[model samples]
Target: MEDVMSLEGPVLKVNGELVLIIPLSAGGDELMKCSRGISEVQGEFLKIVIPEWLAGMLGIEEGDLVCVHNTDGKFHISPSSPRRVH
Candidate 1:
């Protein structure tokens, strides 16, 4: 997984994997649950590629869904909006 760190501190330790953090934009202490398939798992790290438009943003308040898909024996990472909550 990719090393996720901020100047303040490292939120996650690098296990040779990558993780995406979507921070809520709303001015409240709220949390959203995202569910996506394991498209690719690399050395204890996962490569979750969302949509190009939602590539970089903050928060899960935008929606209540996330999708994870594997295509043709390959890990096709893409953005998904799930209907159910995990």
Candidate 2:
């Protein structure tokens, strides 16, 4: 699990639809949902929050780094990218 800020506020909207935001480092195997959106925070960070069922389906747990992507009209998840060497 990677470190993430737990935000408590109104749900975020992107282009008029709500979305689940995660760090750019996050990745996943498959997307079980459709139509995700993205937004930036403070011009320097990204964030995400997922439902427990989605997390379980994606095998995501607390502290585990996960990824989400969009294809066509659906969203997918997978393990985060491998660390890059400097």
Candidate 3:
């Protein structure tokens, strides 16, 4: 079977600021290469500082829903609007 991973929910905040943080083990080197220029490289993870330019550009707001997708190690995060549950 193929290995696949996915997560859905809201963005996270650290020290009162929103961020997109992922572990190196999650995506390997590919994520680092992809996160360059937009994220800060910490000890074992890449943290993307969000909530201003990024959030505005993507129309993402605090408490907004988000979807996280991992494919072959790489990760993608997208904003989702509130939807009524069935």
Top-lDDT candidate index: 3
Ten contiguous residues minimizing lDDT sum, candidate 3: 27-36
Error of 3 at 77 (Å): 4.1
Q: How do all the candidates rank in terms of TM-score, highest first?
A: 3, 2, 1
Native-to-model Cα distance after best TM-score fit, residue 5 in candidate 2, in Å? 22
Provide C-alpha RMSD values for all models, in order: 14.9, 13.0, 5.0
Q: Write the per-residue lDDT of candidate 1 for residues 1-86, one digit (tens) a residue.
A: 43222111112222433343323342001211222352243444333434434434422223334333222323322334423446
Q: Each prediction's TM-score against the native?
A: 0.23, 0.37, 0.55
TM-score of 3: 0.55
Worst 10 residues of 1 by lDDT: 4-13
lDDT of each: 0.30, 0.42, 0.64
lDDT of 3 by residue, 36-82 (tens): 66677788876776757767667776677776555665656677764
What is the lDDT ranking, best to worst?
Answer: 3, 2, 1
Listed per model in order, the count of residue pairs whose N, CA or C atoms clash below 3 Å is 14, 17, 0
What candidate 1 gets wrong by more than 4 Å, as runs, is 1-64, 82-86
Higher-ranked by TM-score: 1 or 2: 2
Model 2, 1-86: lDDT tens digits are 43222222223344544435543333321222242342333233354455567555655455455544554545444646333448
